[model samples]
Target: MPETARIRNVAVVGHRGTGKTSLVEALLFQSGAINRLGAVEAGTTISDADEDEHKRQLSIALSLTHATWQERKLNLVDIPGDPSFQGELRTAARVVEGLLVTVSGVMGVEVGTSRAWRLGDELGLARVVFVNMLDRERADFFRTLEQLRSQLSPQCVAVHIPIGTEHELTGIVDVLHMCAYASPEGAKEGEPGPIPDDIADIAAEYREKLLDAVVETDEALMERYLEGQELDAHEVAAALKAAVTKGEVFPVACGVATKNLGTHAVLDLLVEGVPSPAKKGSPIDVDGASTAVFVFKTVADPFAGRINLFRVLKGRVTAETTLVNLRGKGKERLGSLLELQGKEHKPALDYAEGDIGGVAKLKEAQTGDLLVDKEVAIEVPDFGFPEPVMSFAITPKTKGDEEKVATSIRRLAEEDQTLHLRRDQQTGEEILSGMSQMHVEVALERAKRRFGVDIELHPPRVPYRETIRREARAHGRYKKQTGGRGQFGDCHIVVSPFEEGEYEFVDKIVGGVIPQSYRPAVNKGIQEAMHHGELAGAPVQGVRVQLVDGSYHTVDSSEMAFKIAGSMAWKDAYMNADPVLLEPIMELEASVPDDVV
Candidate 1:
């Protein structure tokens, strides 16, 4: 594994179609990491290599890749921008030190922009918003900057201004150095050139604005600038980086990712401008003790079993180490370490602070489990998952498929945190739920692809409760005659509502009318019978049954005979008890669009 100091872990976040994945490809291409860039529509991009992602034309999971720039190793994570895949975004946040938020110059200040801003704020990550898509029509850098100021935050300031408008984007003005960088392909370290003739005045104006934003971070710089003293480029860069990493100032840069414009320059800015993990705050924790690693995703394979992806927070982890699972409570051994590159895994032995990696199947370890060193037990807080809002009932097609359905559902749930599968206790139906209808459909697709389990989905049944409205009495008798022996039992039961909310069973027999041993058998039968109501086959609730009187034959009576008698009595009494079905009304507190509400 690589040391933390040599590693640059940064997350590329932005709205959909802002060219985040394309920027990643460009970075890889220029860094000599990959020979050629793959297109998103072709479903051959390195980051979006997953089959499900390719079919959907979007990233469903965080894609982890690495590249090297100027002797420094960069760990790049490209995250999905869609809300349904926010799980991937959260995973990326746990592993990176700085955020590179991409914004489309054509569509400024979008919903994705607002979301990424708030996410970075919540994680306390240093931010640098790259305004991309400069060559497209209606792509106004200045207008986009104004929109960012109005909708996002006023702390944003331009550090680099484009040289010209659309179709004429040949270079950019460096505000700090008072220099112009021209690129035929818009890459960094291109042949140095004099400031372009047309945009020199505009560059001069923004350079002062850039200097003003930097000077506020240091009193000496502020005084020097206010007194008309000129500061050098090196001094300016240092102050600007400090302010940006400290969340005082957010410097915006512009480029066209698809045309390979300004990508290398953006890479340089990330390496030089972003903060290192050591300078960042300590890792996240739950209690007073330092945090242990918690995995948010696991991929099950027929050959590999399970590949668990996780982030190391407070401590170092190596192969063959044992950890106590605060959730699973069993000791888990760290298997072979893995660094994910596209869909492949590169072998490693250990990982350090703020590093993201994976390990082969850890028996008994699961997502949301805090893997402690066992000697020093500490628990990390679990990651939050949105509640599943949509549901469907799934049934298998083939004979003897009922048991396979449960196993397949569990495996699918293990893979997707957003998916939930459980038996509806009230309705007695197996329900699979997720964020939306499409989410559940994707889960079904994965089930067929990964687990080879085919299922038919139907609307989930509505769960209802059943209760009795009046009291009733029932007497039941059970007798079995055989050649050698006989069985006889009798019981009288009184059924009524128990305060209209509680379900209880009481034995009030006196004078040894029925043996104490037989009383439990009667209660068991009533409890078992309560599982299915007489109406609509729903579970019965809010009622109590009492065993009042009964007689038993000394030699012939048995527990089975008493149970049968009690079950019969309950069924007979239930019809006359005035049972009614009660529909469940969910008291929902939701924050939706005002028009919908």
Candidate 2:
């Protein structure tokens, strides 16, 4: 097991089209994890290995990949920037202690930037900003830096400045080292050199600002700086890590990710500035010192039953380590403990405390489930999912494939907590819901591709109900004299709004006006009328029907005649009583940053 100081679990988050994945690729390539860099346009990147992602050209799910920088393992979880896939974003936030927030150099501080920053604040996560895509048209690093300061936080200080503008961009100025690091087009890493004269003065200014921010986090450093004593890079870096972990400072780095410019500088900052899990992770009870794994994400693999990616919260876990699932209280052996490189699984020795790892084929382990050793006990953290915003009714395209469709939906929902399958009580249709319409569509598409079950999406039918407003009375006389033993029935009824309940029928008959045996027929008829209301043909609600005075032929007043009379009378009274239609409403609360709005 690696010491807690060597492990750094970070989530790469930003808006769509901000080169989050591209930056991750550059980092991996610079660290020698991959020999070649893969472009997102070609869909050859390891992080985005799914076919659906290739088709959409956007991340619909989070991907886990790691790189080694100076013998320190950096577990990089690349999360989708799109708001529609916020579920994945939240999932990544739950397990990681730091965030590598990517900002588009051209677009500056966008909606996604604000959202990610606020999320970091919400979780008290240490944040590092990368101003990516500086090689694109109209990309400005200084302007984006100002936006980061004004929009995100005043503590957003730059540790590096870009060497050139769009198209002419070649390198970055490492403000902390007071030097320049340039990378030629297609280079794997940037080499440090003397800072350009044109940007030297500006780099010094940013360096001074960085020192100012870093020293404030440490009283001793501040006092030393106040006494005119110079602080070296190492002193500032150590203080910067504490500041970043406490969210008192945010260090900004610049890069053209596709060209791999400033890749090594970013990695160096990540290792030097980001906090180890021990500083940022939740405090653990030393008395309950035993292995515990918190499963944060689960991927449903066809060949492998379930791939649960977990964070070792308390102690180390390795292959064949049997742990008790907190949910099911069942023993689950770590059969295939592996570290993930996107879809590829590499065998892992063990995941130390606060380190993330994957284990395939746990019996009932799932997202948000904590598995602890039998000797250890802990409460599972609640990583609540976003309520599905859009819903649609889905049915199997082919008949008698209901079981297959339902099974596919169930399995899909298991993998994605945001995807939901529910049956509408009023419409009697299977409803599929997700964060957005596209979210639902992509899940359904995956169900088709993975489970071999095809389903058709229909607009979710509105569960409208019906009710009466006013009190009204009516009479119905059904008299048929054909030949012998004809049908003769007479009844009166009043339909009114029932304040307390959904539906009620009262028989107010006296002196055998309507026979006792046939009175139940009156109630049955009114109930049948309640099923189909008068307004939109929906089920009537909060209706009270009263069977008042009525005459019936002793011989021909059978249950059938009275039933028809009651039905006719109730229909007339319902129409006379002001009827209204009601639809179900959902109350949703959204936590959106003002800048994003």
Candidate 3:
């Protein structure tokens, strides 16, 4: 097992198209985890290996991988940038101690960038900003840094400045070291050199500002700086790490992830500046005796069955351990412990406290579940999943495939918490809802491809109702005189609008006018009529019926006869009692960009 102090769990998150995946790929390559760097456009990046994600050229799920840098184990989680996959991002945020938020230097601050920053603030995790895409045309690091200062926290200070702008970007000036590093095309490590003459003044200015920010975090350092003493670089570096851990400052770095430019510096900063899992705090309090694991995600592989990815919050978990699932209150036998690398898994002997690992085929365990020793019981808080905004009514393409479709939907929902499935009680349609149209569409595609279920999508129907407007009375009679035992029945009913509930039936007949046994038949017939309303064929609501008078022959008056009379009486009275169709009204809350509104 790896020592807790040597583990650095950080999540890479940002807006879509901001080079988050690329940055992760570059980090892996620089650390020698992968032989070659993979590009996002080619769908070969280790973080985005899902077939659907490859087809779409965007990340649809969270990817977990690890690298070793400077003898420190860095566990990196690459999260989807799209809002539709915010559930994955939030889960990643909860497990990691630090957030590496990448911002597009060309686009500056976008909506996703703001959201990523807010998530970090909410979790109180140490944050580091990477101004990516510096090699792209029109990319400006200083402009992006200014935007971060205004939009995010003003505590954000630059630790590294670009040597040039846009296409001319070839190197970066390390402000803390007061030196420049030349990064030619396709180079993994930049050559250290003196600061360039052109941007020397600018670098010095930012360096002074950085020093000012760093000194404020420590009183002794502040005194040294105020006394006209030059602060040592090592002292400043140590102070910067402390300040970052305390959330007093967010150090900014720059890189072009696609070209692997300046990534080695970023790795050095991560090892030096970010806190270990032990320092960031554990998800659960350590009780010293009991074992605890929090399952953050579940993957349903068609071949391997259920795979649960979890973090050991306390104690050690080995292959022979048996855990109790707090959510289900059932015993779960431990399978082989595994560590994940994209879609591949490697068997592990055990997972120590503060380490993240996976277990395959836990019968009763699920995402957000707490697995602990049999003697201990605890509930792990759930990641807050956003409400689904888009909805679609689904129909099985094959006539008898409804059950198959439903099973597929459930499995898919298990994989993605953002996807929701429910039967519309009013419309009687199986509805699938998600964060966006694309989210639902992708789920349906997965259902078809992964589970062999095909379905057609349509807009959900509005559930409407029919109600009575006024009160009216009518008499109905049924008689047959063709045979020896003829059927005969009669009834008089009064109908009116009701406010208490959907529909009510009352018996007002007296003196055996309607027999007590036959009254139920009359009520049943009227309820059937209400189900198929007089207006628009919608279900009837807000109405009442009263059986005032009725007559029946002793031998000829059967339950069927009375039921027929009740149905006829309801139809006559409903026509005279004015009725109207009521469409359902739903209150909705919408979120939009300020410019759109």
Candidate 4:
């Protein structure tokens, strides 16, 4: 295992289609982690390897991979940028100490970009913004940099600027070192050289701004800068690192992720600028000799069973370690620790503090659960999943497949916290809800492909009920004559609007008009009638019934006879009680464009 001081855990996050995945691939290739560069269009990128992700050409889940740069192990988490998959991004935020937010040079600022910035702020993560796609048409690095400064934070300043504009983007000028790195077509690392005379003026301007920002971290440096004292490059770099660790500055870099240009510089900056896990300090206090690990993501593989991916917050975890789940209050025996590379698992000797690893087939462990030593009790904060906005009723395509579909959905829900499943009691339909319609569709596709369960989706039905607005009284009687015995029963009931509950049945009989044992039978029959309402076959509610008087034959008027008489009396009173159908009311809030409104 790499030492905690040399391990840098960083998350690559940004808006959809901002080339986050491509940037990760470029970093991996530049670091010698992989010999060949992978492209998203070719579906060969290691991170976006899932079938659904390949079909959509977008990441739908969090991908974990690592690389060695300058002898420092960088654990990179490539998260999905689509809003529908924000849960994956939230999970990534919890484990990583720093964030590299990518902004498209052409698109500038977007909803996803803004959201990522806000989330990074909430998590208190040190951030480095990369202006990507500089080689694409209409891409402008300076314009995007200004947008970032105006919209996200004024502390955002460019440490590196593209040497040329779109179509002529061949190199980057490093403001800190006052040098340039130029690359030819299809090259991985650029050759360092003196800054071009044409770009030197602008590079100097940004370098001065960078120096000014870096000095703010120290009062002595700021005083030296005001007095026009020359500062060493190493001192400036040290101040920049200090400011970034405190979230006082967000260092900006530029690159074309698709072309692998400037990626080597990005890796260099990550190693030199971003803080290691040890430097960032532990998120929680680790005073005692206890172990604690937080499970951020759970994978439900059919063949492999449940795989738990967790980050060690304190102490050490090894094979055969027994940990207690604080949420479940149960003991868990950890068998083997595995290092994750996308979906592949490699055996790991142990996971030390500030390290992340995975284990297979954890029975009571799940996402957001904390596994700790029995002596320590601690609670980890959970990711706030957005409420589902779209819902659809799902049905099995074939009969007798309901259980299969349900089991599959439950398993998928275990993997994705954003997917919700519930049964509409009134409509008797299984409803699937998600962030969007496409989110639900992707979940269904996974269910079909992974679990071999086919289902049909439809709009969910609204549930309604029936209630009375007025009161009425009625008399009901039942008599029958057969061969040697005769059946006879009579009842009188008063029905009124009930304010306390759905329905209430009161027994009020005098002089043994109705037998004590038979009163309960009357209540049962009324309940049955209420369930199968008289109008629209909906359930009846908000009504009360009082059994005031009744008569019965001793030999023939049994519980069955009283039950039938009670049913008749309820129907007779309900018809005269002025009943009305009540539709379901939904309290909803929606956001719409002004023109549409």
Clashes of each: 1, 1, 0, 0
> Candidates 3 and 4: which is better by lDDT?
3
> Per-residue lDDT tens digits of candidate 4, residues 1-597?
888888888889999999999999889988888777888999989888788899999999888888999998888999999989998888888888889999999999887888889888998988988999998899998889888888889899898999888988878888988888885454567567999999989998999999988888789999999999998878888888788878898999997887787787788777767787788776655445378888888886455677888888887888878888877789887786778776666788898788877888678888888888865645467687877878999999989999999999988887788999999877899999998888999999988998888989999986678889899997878888786777777889999999733788998898898889888888887788888678877889999999999898888787877788888998999989998888865568653322235
Ten-residue segment with the worst summed lDDT in candidate 4?
Answer: 588-597
The estimated TM-scores of all candidates read: 0.77, 0.86, 0.84, 0.83
Higher-ranked by lDDT: 2 or 4: 4
For model 2, the stretches where C-alpha displacement exceeds 4 angstroms are 282-289, 302-305, 375-378, 469-531, 541-571, 583-597
Please give the CA lDDT of all the candidate structures: 0.78, 0.84, 0.85, 0.85
Residues 483-539 of candidate 3: C-alpha lDDT, one tens digit per residue: 799988789999999983478899999889888888888888888888877877788
Misplaced by over 4 Å in model 1 are 166-168, 181-189, 285-294, 300-305, 314-316, 320-322, 464-597
Total residue pair clashes for candidate 1: 1
Candidate 4 global lDDT: 0.85
Q: What is every candidate's alpha-carbon RMSD to the true fold? A: 5.5, 4.2, 4.2, 4.5
Q: List the residue pairs that clash in candidate 1.
A: 186-262
Which 10-residue window of candidate 1 scores lowest in summed lDDT?
588-597
> Per-residue alpha-carbon lDDT of model 2 for 1-597, expressed as tens digits?
568889888999999989998888889988998888998899988788888889988887899999889888899999999878888888888888889999999999888888888888987888899999898899999999988998889899998898889988878988887888786566666457998889878888889999988898899999999999989888888888778777889999998888888788778777766778877664333247477777888897656667999888777787869988878889999979887887678778887888888889788888777777864556554555778889999999999999999998888777788888988876799999888988888888998888888899999888888887899999988888888888878888888889734777787887888879988988887788778877887888888888888898977778988888888898888889988888877997765545558
Candidate structures ordered by TM-score, highest first: 2, 3, 4, 1
In model 1, how large is the Cα lDDT of residue 390? 78
Candidates 2 and 3 compared: the better one by TM-score is: 2
